[model samples]
Target: MDVKLPEGLEAFLAAAGWGDAVIEPLAGDASFRRYFRLRLGEQSAMLMDAPPPTEDPAPFLRAAKWLDANGLRAPRILAEDAPRGLVLLEDFGEVRVREYLDQWPADEAEVYRAAIDALVELRRLPPGPFLDYSLAEYQREAKLFVDWYCSARGLDVDAASYSAAWEEVLSPMLPRQRPGVVVLRDYHAENIMLLGSLGDQGLLDFQDALVGHPAYDLVSLLQDARRDVAPELEAQMLDYYLSKTGAGADFTADYARLGAQRNAKIVGIFVRLWKRDGKPRYLDYIPRVWALLERDLAHPALAPVARWFDANVPAGLREAGGGSWQP
Candidate 1:
């Protein structure tokens, strides 16, 4: 109710002939950024309020432009105040993949297939000048879990052992990987929108687009936050991706490694979200993520890391904040 607009934002809207518009705050995630839906006549727009010193709209704008140029479905930027970290964008509506999936469970396969298709198409585009979403970056992100969540649960993680095992499992994977065009780091159900019947879903929150493996986005999608996509479906989708990309026989091992790596990182991320960010709703999903990690670890290719987790990591760590693990 007390949504704060940037300085001179009202004036800017007034001069742009949108003075009569009504703005309402929209639910936001953990980021410092805030969003508002603006209604003008029958048309609507979305405004991003990213306060400066902590949030910047430049990277998002640049990534959006690059995606648009590369034939992706990112929102078109209508206006901006980069210095103030504010951006006005075309509204993509409220039909997230989560909502659509809930409404039409019978269409899960078709809808998820469409999402996979979009990911493949996005991966086909040439890489842009975003940022390196490298193994080091992933390692850094994964460590956040131990620092926050593990510590919160009163678990003392052997940092050296964990890092050594992680590197032992993931290091060899880097060279074997065929670099892809670009990966939308969080290309999941929540970030994708069912725009309409245009056969195109809206891509949102892709500011972290990076140059990475083609399998990365697929892992993010099937291994999502809101729901537990079945392992069978996950395998089928991985095979579908492999076939479409012509990735050859070597891809199977690499895909499994990537899946394990992604699941591990997400487990840590979900923990950090609950422990540090005070978003405990994510805690209930940790067990499912850990189960996915365990399944991925079953691949013979991940023996070293799997052994470390199974041996050193306490069972209490997995059941730290349990809700349901079978999903």
Candidate 2:
């Protein structure tokens, strides 16, 4: 799985005073961005190659700065060549929460407690310098399921009804986001680094942070697509968060609504990754996401979107085309 170094990267690294470092390719996510670990004797840093036109390091840099400024642990920027889309960042080490939890399932609750506490802390802070997660954006994201997932499943759905359903459900919550908090759009176990202690977390992949509902990130965490979180654990964590924040009664409905929206978006995005980006492995997570989406749809707040699903997408077809689905 060797990846070729990007053009001019050597010159860029040399100019940054790391000409003699050893470079090793790192695991990449569902993006055009590539990462490499740079080791200079005892020191280490990560080189993020978010090539232009498709990916940009500007958002990452901004989000990192804000998180660091607010006492959160994001990778420290060692050096940057933003025009070339190259950034040298502090290596948060190899202890990922997702992998660690898999090996030590006993510590799941304790670890998730810390993650939930982090979210509660985030809600206490004011919104960051990002755009609102508006009703239109919510509609656009939910539509990904219709645009990619439906097409891949060979099921022609009522696209207009889908849009209206999302709008109807999401419009009320938009008002709650008046003085919105910073919602780390991807706040799952995989994106978190367990540095030293479970309470001490390192955040990653937060470039898409937005001023949105407080419950959105919570949904992202509890209703994870990559891993199966036990229903008991999910319930415990939700109660823990509610006790910590003293959030209003509407929080439950808001969490469910956002969960359905985010899960729908992920289902579509996974399909798009396979169909458009030639990454079929993402399809394996489709069934897991569908399960989460179905759970969310059970909430009363999601009645409209649930009706759309009932009328258009069949239960058998909803998750029948994950890994073996062909375009």
Candidate 3:
């Protein structure tokens, strides 16, 4: 069975002046979006198939323009047909930070430092036009654990208490995010492209960008789901970021708090991907995320949420497949 190209994809590519290009299917992420690598002689571009109503390319377009205008290394958009959900984009060749580091483990410090530097640079810019990562949004995301994880594991826990715990833990930290920065919600190694040397990073998968606490993206980078960042490296990167930004003492606590929140969201998301979307491979990352979440929960800032977890989610069930359900 061959993978079918989206309707009108060929015409869209031809209209973008790459009519004779060779198209090759590219690996897609967790979203409904599909990608193709197009080559015509010396010219190459990425074709994004973000068909609606399950997918939309408008947000990607908006973030790409904003990032490029602000001196960030987002891919350049060559052409777009928003309603049809097709776009031609600059091909930022295949060297991703994760794969690169896997091959050259010796350069971890240099590469990670560059990633932190990119975050610092992003912090200096005015946030792009986007919705805030509001308290309601925070609570909504946090509840995914209870919504999907608990239900899947057959646990009849106190849902209201879980919500209350998150409220107690997160409310105080909300004010610290006043006039937040543009947080690329998925700023991890996989989405990062090694443009040239150690420090040159090309960004991707930023359609979910939001105006949120700066620490959020830092957590996303340091506490990645798919990759295991060393504890020492995570510490060095955190300190490096703080030294560069001059963030106050409270920043560490904020980082821990956000890490717990983000990790919890990811656990639920992975479960949802398995149970709802039929993508069970995401289950493999659960143990890693659980470890990160537990570490984050250790901070005093997360005591309330930590207590809730202690009482609700059993230690055995925290692993891949909720200690029962299998792919």
Give the lDDT ranking, best first.
2, 3, 1
Candidate 1 shows a clash count of 0
lDDT per residue (tens digit) for residues 158-261 in model 2: 99989988989988888887799999899999999998997888999999888999999999999998989999999999999999999998999999999999
Give the poorly placed runs of model 3, Cα more than 4 Å off: 318-325
Q: Cα deviation of 13 in candidate 1 (Å)?
A: 2.2
- By the lDDT metric, which is better: model 1 or model 2? 2
- Residue 70 error, candidate 1, Å: 0.9
Answer with 1 or 3, whichever has the higher lDDT.
3
Structural RMSD, model 3 = 1.4
lDDT of each: 0.76, 0.90, 0.90
Candidate 1 lDDT over 118-190, as tens digits, reads 8778767767886666778767766665665556556666777777777777777676444556778788888
lDDT of 3 at 79: 93
Residue 285 in candidate 3, Cα distance off native in Å: 0.5
> TM-score for model 1?
0.92
Error of 1 at 146 (Å): 1.9
The per-residue C-alpha lDDT of model 3 at residue 318 equals 61
Model 3, 148-263: lDDT tens digits are 88888889999999889989988888898878899999999999999888888899999989998999999999999999999999999999999999998889999999999999
